[model samples]
Target: MVASVEEVSSSLVREYLSRKGLKRTIACMDEEHPRTEASINNRSQLRETLHIEDLYRKNKVDKSPFKTLLEIIVKHHIEQFVSLEPNDTKADEITSAVVCGKQSKIRPETEEECPSQPSYRSLMCEQDGLSSHDHIASANDSDCQKSQPLIPFLENNVSFGQRKPDINTMKPEDTQRSRSNRIRRGMMAGPVPQESTKKRQSRRAEVSQPLLSKEEENKQAQERLLFTGIHKKNLERSLTGISIADCGGGKPSGRVQSENSNGKVEQNMQKTRNVKTEPNLSDLNVSELVLDDIDDDDLREFSKVSLQRTVAKCQYTGRPMDKQTATELKAVLLGSSLNYFSVEWRNQSFTFSEIPELSYGIVQRKGGPCGVLASIQAFVLKKLLFENTEISYTGLQRLRPSNATRRQCLVLAMAEILWRAGEEKQATVAIKSGKSHFTPSDHFRSEEVLEKIMCFTVDNLKDLQFILEQHIEQFDSGMLGCILLTISAVLSRSVEKVREDMDVPSTTLIGAHGYCTQELVNLLLCGRAASNVFDNDMELDSGNGNMMLLKGIKSHCDVGLLSLFEHYNICKVGAYLKTPSYPIWVVCSESHFSVLFGLQRELLTNEDKGLEFDLYYYDGLANQQEEIRLTISIGNLSQSFQEVDTDLIPPLELCIRTRWKDAFVSWNDTEPLL
Candidate 1:
């Protein structure tokens, strides 16, 4: 008969405790066979002992102190027994008995049986105080019939020691056989001898139970018609569908057999039944049906590939549309496709134009100008206007220049016509004639005229400055005065005031005034203007206007100009005189005297000459002192002053003193020289 479940449970616990090296304290009630030294004899007895020990250790034993010990035993078992070779005889037998209920063979009776039991007379002879073994032997003799079930008793309670069967008195051959059986059982049990057959059976039973119900099966089948995920869901869906036999075996009528499809035959049948009642199948959107099936990566790849293919197709057809043309086509297609299918492509279409506009109506929706097209139009406009081509006013009006793009083209054409006229040396003739070919008034201004003017002013400043500087020598003092005065006038005006009247940076007006003034200066200094002052044809106003010009020059003088004079002091004479015929030597000497006298007067009067002067003087003196200390820095300065003659320096000094004395005499006679 099989052992009771309680006995098996206890046996398993004892086995576990033994493996964990836990002490077994349960006293067996049937001490009739005095407890011998515990040793396992048979494979069943060995397994039963191990199982009971294991259960005892797991439940009754405290784990806090022996947690690390339990982990070591668990790891050993996993390594030794869990990973045991399938072909290993002992492992195979143990696994089969646990997993499949196959029992190992018992040892033969003759080799296993004890010889004549140890006699009570012998125990008495030995006088060993009637040891537990003797006590068990005496009980066995008296209750031999009842004690025949000792195997059951051992299986129920014995745990964690070698089995003793009156070993000192057992026959030699029986002992040898018993020992061999014990060894075989130990090898078969492997490392985790407490891993019981019943527990393994229960675990396998729990794992094998079906997870889905009839309704769940049907729902899963419907889902399969839609999509299939990996592993768990795929297996569930596969099991839910119908078999070919259930579908009457004519190739399963509703099934779409794709090799890539993971949905099983059973799931497809369930899907077919659910879908049968749904109407308007043709109108059903494929995306709506299978969106869940698509992975994010797959969707991205699809979009990229579709766009690339579309671009390639457009290119290959030779009627290749530009981006604007493509956008227009896509918009038209989207509108038509939406109306035809009663489905909006606003969400479906990829192109920018196909996207919905703000709810502001179609009239408000117009495409903006492209940058490159605007540039090209501007270039074309410049060419048409200035190239001396015969263009009618009617033709110009019909050009339909509504946007910045068309306006730019017209401007460019006008510029080009003017440029060509100049390049051909016909600019003067064209300007004088008034009716000379190309006319481009339409290209004159933009909507943002003030902005354009500001940009123009900023763009041309460097060039304007360069031109002024280059011809600066040609300008007479009168013209230079006018230029400086004009600049000063503009600078003196508040920028806000200028903006109120001019609608541009004050810099623009300042620049234009400077340019015109500089040009006038250039003409006056070069003596290029007509000489007769009152003559209608002459442009010069030589009387009081010239005196006004001198006053403007004096007013314009500032620290900056003075520093320039000091930096290129000799160059100042070269700039003012312009020609050798003018008494440059006399003027330069006088100017140098005036500068020195002015400095001395400022020092005497305790007035500020300016920070520029102070910095120049301080830096120069400091540098001289450093040179005196080091000498190397003054190497190049020796050659720079070579033009100054040592003999002429005395006469220069006398002349400076005379000028200062004359100035002082004139001043002292008038109002006490204050």
Candidate 2:
């Protein structure tokens, strides 16, 4: 095999052996070579290099602990801390030399040298005994500096005195004539001479022109000085009682009175001057000086006097205490706030009336979708289009369904209309597609669709209502969806059919924007005596909500035989009901609504009747048919509740039944329904 190692001199091998404290290896070799002093020194250096190479190859080289650390730090600092300017080629050379552990010959150009550096010429001088390499570097540096000049220190080049000129100074022509000039010119007399229009216009133009030339400027300055001087001189002359022509050129005099004149005697002179020579006081404009000594009482008296006078300026035909006009004015003032009563009087006695005329009135307002329905019923239903609309008109009364069966007839008619309008199918698609407003086909015009549906109207509206109620129980009828349903019912069925279905004479299609509860209640009283008057009238002597609920209940009860209470308060079950209204009552909880019918009326009226109530609840959305028996004796009734002869039974305490639990209720809990 070929030897992998290089041969060492015998002397070097001997030195290595001596350093290792081993026996001299040269004694074992043949002593044929002569050793001179020069040869020994050469052999010693060879031994040192050989030993170093061996140690390095064997991975046993001795080194400072900080040497490798220092080299790594220097390389990192060169790459990280050094910032290279744009096109700084010298920076690249320096970085490369440092990284390679070689000296960098690249020197910064003279111009590029730090401002704090020593002489610039010495850095590039070839006469400094530098070699050819240094000369070449200097030449390259000069070329670089010539190509890229040093940047000036911008921070030290701040300007000190220069400033922007003002706008007024730059354009003196834009300056407006001073206010004093106008006052001074106003003193000039008019109608002195009538020059030709052309000459007058030319003079005006010259006057209005800007003061541009130096001569014009000097002229204006002199005029200003003359104005001040003449005004002072004229003012002094006026104090001396000189004539106007004697002072300045028969110019008009100013209104400024001379302070040097007598305290009271000047007034006599002023009157004579105005009458004989001066113009009218109006033209002179002394209005600002004409003041009256008016204190607070004087102002009051003036206002009183003005108010006492009416359309005609003539005095009232009566004395102050008995003036009919004054009485009339007082009455008008009181009538303006007739709707609002004074509440500031302490210890004031309030009158109580058995009738509801003095009771706190509740103005009915229709709100939300319910309001929309009410508006259509109260306004749209009475139009000529629906004037003749009734059950008889629909040709459904021929079947002779009893009054009890009218609701069934109306429901059937509504269902037939929906079926004809194709809303049922559209609604199903909307539900499946998870969209609320999508109506699938536009095959029929809205009115035509309604008319067609009416043609197919079912005779029994109640049965259809029940089915719809059941369907809605399991589904969410969006607000719009529910409103549309009500609208379709009105369009397809006659007013009589709707009346029967809703158990109220007036059926409404209400919504969030259109109608309110007050309007809805008013609509429910349609065809009744109460319906003719405004729902807000205190003279009507009935609470709007109670009146509406009573009117609806009267349609289903035998209340026509009894006298209408005519005067009633709100939230009272029997306030307007003269007969037994226990058979049906509308219940509302929040936005959800239901109707309750008494299942055991005779039991309720029994002399031994307990505090229990048996009601049949009909929820439109839930389609629930529940017999809710609740104890209402624990619920408190108002102390003011009265048992009138017209009332059928004691007022039923309002209560809410959620699931199977019963709780007392407030009329405020429900909105439009209440």
Candidate 3:
């Protein structure tokens, strides 16, 4: 052979090494590298050839341990995934760098220009990030000619459901008032009176369609949710109890399937390691039965869009509570909760009944949303205590819980809360709604269209919710910020007190810090968080204004307890929060919140010395076939042995004491399940 390319290159390198008198370098080169050739000379091309750009990106922002492995896996998949793609000469190189199912979503438009460097997103990756890379599930490259984005790729194969994006995208808006693509479906106030009949007619004509017949629709819903077989029977037998669902035309509640969905709107119910389901609004809202709370007709049907509904069951009976009955009980409970636990004892003995008058549903222990769930419990209690929303209709009050509107309700409530919490800048930003109350799509679009702001009054509820969700999506801080917002809506504590007691310093958006604090829980239930102690409800901030808010456990709201840890301090949770009026308690473990409840109202009001009741558990995770069941005893139990402080007790036993002074919990020979 004349002279191969490698020989010639090696000879040239040897000559150069001899000229520089680097014999050691020449020897090292000869020993280390048998071949060196560059088909592509530029840095970009070389980086592509090596396929180690992800490694460089990892070095730029990585602080966590698993990020190293993540980068490697992503690199391998990207290389394998990209190579099999069909040639697309017309497509522009994807300008946006996206890591799907991550804390940080796509980078802002500014970061698109820096392709050589990985500048967007934080190092944080979910523990399940590996499984989420559905692009790798393929046996061959030909399987992945479908799409490039990881999220969309997963959405293609394993669809949980149609859920609102957890990570809310943020962008700047020029105007405070939103006018285009807006409709005012007043949730709290019911429907806003039309400013002009002519306009309402025009819009209704454009979007109007025939309403689904209730009988036929519910029939379809039943078949879809349950099968007429032994599985359905088993499911029914295992149900722990009932929950108060919205009075939405008596439709049954259903759980989300992890596989593909059969409905138009799919609710993505993801189960965490702890089995807490990330909430996508449990079919219906916990709207009070109070018909007077809003205009009945307006609340009945404000929007043309029909969303899926979850059934509500009785906490005590495990039977489906009718809409009318649930509404009545909810109204009564709402009336009682407004008292804020300020009730005079009548020596009332709780009369136990098989008929579950008090309905309760179990929402799963979604880890990131405990704070929000806690606040929502308090918020509903607060509304019942204060707002005049009790159901007056004798007949089944047909309505939509309007989860979308409920989000609006929460956002508005949060805006007020943020203001009270001394987050003025964020509150200000959150309160600015476009001219119209409803912006179905392109909620934050920059382009403005001049149209009638029919109802001139601004509703910051929708806008505030978007901001909070966006922030939650941005930092993946979970529901702590949402909890603060909900707490602000119902909490009676003064702004000054809240500012002083808040664990995280005030900012535009409140920080969740990933879990619930004693202070935050206090604020959620007792309308105050003056102390961190989870002991007895006591007098706090006696001085003046809202500052004199109640903290700690209230005298009578005890409904028993369930905690994951056996050694948890029962005194760490305040009385009212541990035992809520909804006949439900949030079972918190590892920062996740599941629900524990009883069907009887007497759990809170029964003053009998030897009180006993059955308690049921529900976690929206839908992992279990039915709700878990347990039993509780109070004031009358004889201990097998005298227990000391150092001697650990089951969390269920000790936590009940937090509510009842001398209570005993019984598993009834059943194994303890937290």
Candidate 4:
């Protein structure tokens, strides 16, 4: 039973050793050992023991301290098994030669005859001469034997295979020197040097060596091909997935049901990471891909065309502007420093010549060309043509009867046109032919257009005033009176300085031919005239004429002249006549007599009348001699009318009184009393 147990345990150990691939040779056991009991339980216990031993071996190999030893043993076994394959003897010999040369130490030759039969070790030493400090010092010396090229027979095939040499294979100092040499070479080659012929040869030699065996190459090639094919398919699949994503695959799961209802979108996402996507350039439309190329001139032309079209549309529609059009027009008008063109339908022309002048006050008052006025005129003409049915072309022609009449007719026509155009002032001026001196119907054989003229004149106060003052004779007395009253009212309301400057009273009598009866009284009473009337006319009789003039003046004097004097606040009248010694008697009109009487009464009535008063009348009957009349009055009344002595009067007073009496008599009998 013990032997059976031993056999079973040995069987188990053999099986374990075979499975673990370990070399095993069992040792013969001693035969004098006691026999062990063998029951079913013991056999089971042996099995259990064997299992435990196997577990212990595995633990020692896989974990901790013994694992390194296990790996070394495994590696040794693999190397031995692999080395059983046949290899080339020539290759082996060459490899041994190279290794032997690398390990050998050879001394440098002396300066005599070179050493015969140079050893492979000497060749290796020469090839690796950079290791010596002396070789570095003699680097520039071409004559040095150490400078000779080494490995002349070996092809320039120094290949750096993927299975690089382990650092442990070389001495640490040698490895450091090799790295320094590599760094020095790199430094010598600057950034962009041409590849030397030696480098090309080395690269060719490296590629020529078959680092990968045929089987391995084939296997790797197949793998690469498969990977490439899979990659392409994956790329296509990813592209399809991208398209799906674009078409709602990336939407909430609730929005889209998947075709394969695995309920695990996360898995699909994981698969997606393994794929690549390529953009489909062909899918883009040609038109969408190409952008239009525009030039500066083209853009400018487009803008011009668009503006012109918009303007044309606006003109054609005749509808009130919508917000957009109005806004555009406003922007254009404000933004641009140019005038826009407008069509004059009546004129049948397009022009920018009539842009409105943005200004205040009377149109054309300044001497510049009147753009606003011209525009208004053109507008009026258009309105006339369209609205006034009675004004045909022939009628229009009749309206302008002659070249001289043309201005008047045109003004009338303009006025009418303006009236129709809703310009009341201009329209009224147009219809009043006489008022504007237009005589519109007179040119066409129409009757005295007085009513229309008056209407026009009345409507335009400024024009009427201008006409009345400028062409005074053209207006009737009634019209002139009306104009004067209007002017007076205007003056009263106007600036005081202007009224004073104009001197309305003087202006009113500016062109009067002669002083009328009433004007004479006003002049005297209001103190508006210069003193002493003198005339050069000497032909007329003075006695009756002078007496008649005095009576006429007395009759005209009434309370009106006195009231005028009071209103003007005339304190006193400077004496033109004085009294004393001589009585200068003269014949004169009754008007002159009346004037003298009034003067005598005023002087005598004054309590402060310091100077005595006298009147003299002269009739220019003789050429040299003068006739004079004098009267003296005192107190508030002239009680005693007596002739003063000639010698008593001052000479100047006598001369003045005599001359005035003669002048008054001559003026009274004139053709028309002024």
Candidate 5:
């Protein structure tokens, strides 16, 4: 065996404390506490006593390891006189150090003659309940030899690793084994009883407390039952003879055993006293008693073994998977998209039938600067091509680009449109190159050029107002939010007409860019521009043109004609409800554009009632869905991606709604929108 071992590291102690949520105790360890400081300084004492090094490598303490470690350390301090075979010199040294501070003994006549350190006395008093006076008496008393301190046998001098005795002693091997068994059983004896003649006389003189009457006992039992919420009878039965013995086999000092003058009781007591010196192996029933019974002496040895076995079985044998669990686990393991045979159970037998796999129509990605339009096309294509109950991650994966950086979403959308246009090679080329065949100027009535033509300038605002006045057929129209939608539809139709005149079979795509949306609305209402040429570059997809367009439109629009609602400030929904002329609302959030159409059945002058109307939302880039109902309330609109009702709609419609919700959506009305 090694003479020295490493102490338990501070890291292990920290991890143990953290797992137990006792971080506050670590705060004290850092502070100045004498016992802790002494323990830190006296590393050798702790190392020798608890064998702290082995605590981590082999944690033998089954319950409350920290508590067991503390008990071991405390027991080591008190083991000098409490040993089964005491060495006189060691006992004297412990007594002298504790009571007289290196002096041999403390005189009874002059008790105050010997001084002791306050820290040492306080530490001892805190660790054990023994006062300095009690320590001196315990050290000097002859009864100490018979009555030892209440510490577990394992914590004393006897180590589990001690070498076994030679077999050729005085007895045969069988006899030696029996004698060793008797000694082990004797060591499992209950706590030492009072033995002094003077103590016995004092005990006889002391009055014993009277036992509770039957009625009072019943009342107390009922109170306990009420407190624990257990039934009255069950509580009473459990309390009758419930003896919670320590796992160490030591009997609790306060436990009361019934008086037994039987031969068995006498024989057992006699055996405990004499067995340590000269064990009688024949008397003790080693076969009947289990070795594990030494840890818990209260329960029958056989029952404890059965209990341990039952617990071990429960820990090892987990519940078997049922039909539902098996099906779900199988679905998850092999991708959910993979087909599996459905098993139906009838009576004792089950029939398995193969479920056919679903096929998907491949939608290609189109090229050029139509990513937004491509996304919308992909969304529509998915819904039109596939038949599914709800929007699935697998279905959406086909349309969306896996890589976010430099996405060819527009190319995919263009490909889908060109595929519909019957130009498969061009579509393939568009997807591969990720570039548009038609330049910014090639398409005549193309919606792509609408933003370039409707250049938002102070000079253009008057033309925008003129254009709007002409297009908004009825003043104070119920179709206020439909302005953007109407412009998009009109532009789309005009582009299709031009494509028809040119004999171009492919349908020209339209996208709802934030910058172009406001200006397009202006151009559609203001009438045709003199020329498509603009002050700014025609290719203004990624720029500050949208912001400038918004500013220019806001400046020219009639008072109360337009209102803005930030998705984040949705709590200010009340302000938008009261706009005169049923304002054309534009919810400018993130980089997306959405129109709020006032859907009031009848005109109302009252602001309170006016605010209660439903607002129809038009998001051209809204995936597969056509329109959204933005129902306004006092504080919020009824909307959430999770709460969205996509049940009746196609998978593509649901995908669009999901994408919208994923973008600039608010979780709670009180919190800001994402």
Candidate 6:
């Protein structure tokens, strides 16, 4: 290996990160490279890891063959190394490194997975999923130079020049018997590329290079076909337990299989299937699709695997936040966060700010972090809705207490948004020892709990739950102060009381749901929990008598849900929820909550018949996946490529329409995503 292995490996990892669209990770690596924990030390290992050895040789970059194995070790983490048995011979120690970024451990396979011929072939077959029969049949094919009884247990000590002659006369049985000793010859070296009298041995050897290229291309094409889209992503997780890093194992660096190996393939498949593993991240399109089934262990694995390779930044400072320093976020930080992202349309593109602080605090999906999610939406919207610069990252970082960290700043933001979202927006409101009083929010109905901001004080973190139980009896069980970063709420009420007030049957309230619903959202916004999405107040039977439901939001709101307006089709909804004071609205499609915001504020006021305004999508459940920035152009001109409205509308488009009615969204060059 060259002395500059770290430099070279760093460059290769950078390229890999970029190719995977990991922009933030790339930035992180640049800021902290030579400081990286692990790296591949040579060309052969690099080629094998990337499966681009042919691509490297194709462009005549480095024609070096594999002569040494990778020794990628993390700094100060030497205990992670697992060496093979000392007596097993040098071939048994030829280990491969996993390049998922943080920790690259050498996978210890069974003794049969050594680098000697047969076992090496099996290992390659395991990786590239190639079969052995292809090699067996090719033994007597025209590609072979000669045929004769071959020697069994042929030692690798054969002279380099005599090796070709010695192997040409080798028999299949002899090859198998000598598999353990044939280490120098290697697996799938393809008989050193033979030639007949139609070409001399040198010409044949030269011809083999082109054949290697063709074979590599065919393998790559097949691999691409085998692992496209979600299949490819799933393979990354299952093969290496890497969530964000590219496993680069989609196309194993080997050839295709044949009929005889079908049984071996099935045997391997059975072994793989028998390995008890967790279910994979599903391809479901529902909003809560990933979280409903996601586990805490998954979250832990997700964090460990991600932080191993990726070093995210402090969202406020843009300084490197390595995995160790990042762990603090989970223990101390609390609050909702804004996921500002950008989009493109009509060749025009825009990007919003990033909340890279999602290190240990990635969305806690099972609890439906809607309070955190919605509060952040309100925070970001308020930041843009008002002239206050305090909402900005740097501005928030410089918040009161002077020494407050980035996490505490988010908690402060959540509290501020609740206050701002209240009717009697006060400088301070705190519930004290066993005392509870309600001051109405401007929008809180006089009929229900007139109070907003069910403030409670907690001297000890352990006592937060007890304090909430004693004071705010209606506090959402799943989303408590521990998760939302505060012991206060904009409003809180029991579902039974809400249902009774809305004339809903008690039969529907039997079970505890793990997701947020319309009534809960309305309760969060207004003190009264209304069930119906109406333009104005509707008279309803409260079982006591006819009662007036407060007409939906009167004055412009800080943040709004567009699904209610879209589903009800009320013209008056446009003034309140459809268009908040700012250009952001929470979109609920397929029972998930994403936000749609635009770069320009005119998007809300523009009343043109076919008004065109750009919008962006931030998946409610994802803090890691890339958000979409849509450049919308709505006009009478329709292109032939545009599909009719009757076609299956992608869920993304439906979410967008919940915010903008009669929107004719064109994907431009992008295929419509379902």
Model 2 CA lDDT for position 391? 31
Give per-residue CA lDDT, model 1, range 1-674, as digits (tens).
Answer: 55455554443444344344342132131112111123221224644543535633553355552333334356556667877777666775575344423354443445333333423333331332333343344334344323332333333333445454665678989767755654444321123255465455334323422566656545545564455422223222233332223335344533342333443223232222222222222222223333323445547744654444343333211122123322222222122111111111111110011101100001101111111112122233233323324333232221212122222333332222222312222111000111212221332221121111111011122322332232222221111212222221222222233233221222222112111221112112222111111112213356786621211111111111121232233322222221112111121122221111111112222322221111001011011121011111111223434455635333333222221221111121212100
Candidate 2, after superposition: displacement of residue 498 in Å?
A: 9.3
Q: How much lDDT does candidate 5 score?
A: 0.29
Name the better of 2 and 6 by TM-score: 6
lDDT of 4 by residue, 301-370 (tens): 4455444434333321112212332223222212221222211111121111111111001112121112
Q: What's the TM-score of each model vs. the native?
A: 0.13, 0.21, 0.30, 0.12, 0.17, 0.37
User: What residue runs in model 3 are displaced by over 4 Å at the alpha carbon?
Assistant: 1-366, 378-497, 502-513, 529-531, 534-590, 599-601, 605-607, 620-625, 635-650, 661-671
Considering TM-score, which of the candidate structures 3 and 4 is the better prediction for this target? 3
Comparing 4 with 6 on lDDT, the higher-scoring candidate is 6
On lDDT, the leading prediction is 6
Query: What shift in Å separates residue 174 of candidate 2 from its native position after superposition?
Result: 99
Q: For each candidate in turn, give its C-alpha RMSD to the true structure in angstroms.
A: 38.5, 40.2, 28.8, 53.7, 30.3, 26.4
Q: Which structure is stronger by lDDT: 2 or 4?
A: 2
The top-ranked prediction according to TM-score is: 6
Across residues 1-674, which tens digit of lDDT does each residue of candidate 5 receive?
33222323442343344345453464354332212211222233444544565643343454544433444445455553587345455564565455633333323443333333334433343343333333333233344322323322212322345533433343676645645553343321233344565444334324242475656545543443342232322222222322233325744333222223331110011001111232222222223332211223334543544444443333221122123322332222122212221111001110000100101111111121122222232223323224222323342233221111002222222223323222122111100112223332322222221121221111222232332333222211222112222222233223333233221222122222212332222222121111121222222244665521211211121101122222233322222122423333333333343333343423224334224434333333332122234333332324564475535332322222221223222222222122
Q: CA shift at 543, candidate 4, in angstroms?
A: 43
Name the TM-score of candidate 2. 0.21
Worst 10 residues of 5 by lDDT: 350-359
- Backbone clash total, candidate 6: 12
Q: Give the Å shift of residue 138 in candidate 6.
A: 72
lDDT score of residue 280 within candidate 2:
20
Model 1 scores worst on lDDT over the 10 consecutive residues at 355-364
TM-score of 4: 0.12
Better of 4 and 5 by TM-score: 5
